[model samples]
Target: MLDWDDLRIFLAVARAESLSRAGRALKLDAATVGRRIARLEEEMSAKLFVKSPQGYALSEAGDRLLPHAEAAEQAFAGAQEELSGAAGQLTGQLRIGAPDGCANYLLPQVCARISDANPGLEVQIVALPRVFNLSKREADMAITVSRPTAGRLTVQKLTDYHLHLAAHREYLANSAPLTCKADLRGHRMIGYIPDMIFDKELDYFAETEAQVVGLASNSASVQTRMVQSGAGVGIVHDFAIPFAPGVVRVLADEVSLKRAFWLIRHADDRRSERLTRFAEALGQGLRDEVTRLERLAADTTLAGL
Candidate 1:
């Protein structure tokens, strides 16, 4: 019989792609992790991993075994949750991966509320500029700007948010008057580095003719900060505007863009009651927060008018 303990070690190694890293995560020495993997391979009678300078690469056998292992892991987790009487309250660690904009402006408050309600729950947010790999278990769940077309993943539309051309009041005061998109051509634009835009949804400037990006970063927060510093005009999220006091919408009627945030999870995770509850809470929290922030931005805009 395949040992459940060995399979757990196998999963750690597969995800970390290094014995030492996996060992650290499992709180065991490298030799113990290696022995566990070797034993598991012997029991299965197949080579699960191949060593390369880049680290452990899953062999065909390992690829074939991965889903089964994950399913088993899920089953065990569900059983543990049921036995531990945690069905009424969320506990343990939950990690979420998201683009830095949401991470910086949105999740902090939302997660704080959730954590406060569920005292035993621990939340970790992994903020990055690129897409997360759900299959590799990079996070328990993820928030994304665009729905992924391929993957064994389930996507839930959390909420729709808006963006518009914006600049610091001082920057607008110093620059030439803008009545239309044509005037944007003369202004220094702040935006994502062109080629580094990971998703088409993120190509906020593609729909407009303003081509030159004078200041750019792959991060949304950085782009917003540049605009706050009066560096240049850039497309800024409506929900994020309230956070930057001096940044105000520009050409609001003309250059508005709409986008949606999607919650992504492994399809198999749907069976976990803990995750399902958390997903519901997270979705509602995000919608509420977005609406609240956007309203604040609107009030700020009206006050400026």
Candidate 2:
């Protein structure tokens, strides 16, 4: 029979694609991790991973073993939940991957509230510009701008948020008068690097005439800072506007964009009561927070007028 402990180590290495990384995650030394993997391979008489300069790539046998191992892992998690009784509090670490914009502006307060309610829970937010690979266990769950069309995943639409062309008050004051979209061409534009835009929804300027980006970054937080510094105008999330003082909507009526955040998870994880409870709390928290922030943004804009 395959040892569950060895299988656990194998899963870690497979997900991390490196013995050192797996060891760090499992709190085992790299040599020990390698020995365990070698032992598992010998017992099965199949090479599970191929070491390359890039890292460990799973061999065909490893790929074939993945689903079974994941299923066993889930089964163990379910067993633990059952044995622990109804604790009414989630424990262990839950990592969520999200785009930098949402990560910076929304998750802080939202996660704080969640953590406050569940003292046993540890929440981690992995902010990156690219899509997270749930299949590789990159994160426990992910927040995305668009629903994924392919994957063994389940998605829930969290909330619809607004974005608009915005600039610092000083920038607008010093620059030439802007009366219409046509005038945007004369102003310095701040936005994402065209090639670095990972999602179609993030291509905010593609449909607009502001083709030239004088200040560009892949991070929304960076772009927001650039705009807040009176560098240039850019499309900024309404929920984020209140956080950027002196930043106001430039052409709210003429230029507006709406996008939604989606919560995605491995389809099989729905069976876990712990994750279900956390997901419920996270969804509600995010929805409420977005609404509150957007209202604050609108009020801030109106008050400044």
**Which candidate achieves the best lDDT against the true structure?**
1
lDDT against true structure, model 1: 0.89
| Candidate 1 segments whose C-alpha is farther than 4 A from its true place | 85-87, 302-305
After best superposition, candidate 2 residue 44: deviation in angstroms? 3.0
lDDT minimum window of 10 residues, candidate 1? 296-305
Q: Model 1, 9-84: lDDT tens per residue?
A: 9998999999999999899999999998998889899999999999998999999999889889888876776677
Q: What is the lDDT of residue 269 in candidate 2?
A: 85
Cα lDDT for residue 264, candidate 2 = 97
The global C-alpha lDDT for each of the candidates, from Candidate 1 onward, is 0.89, 0.88
In candidate 2, position 10 carries an lDDT of 98
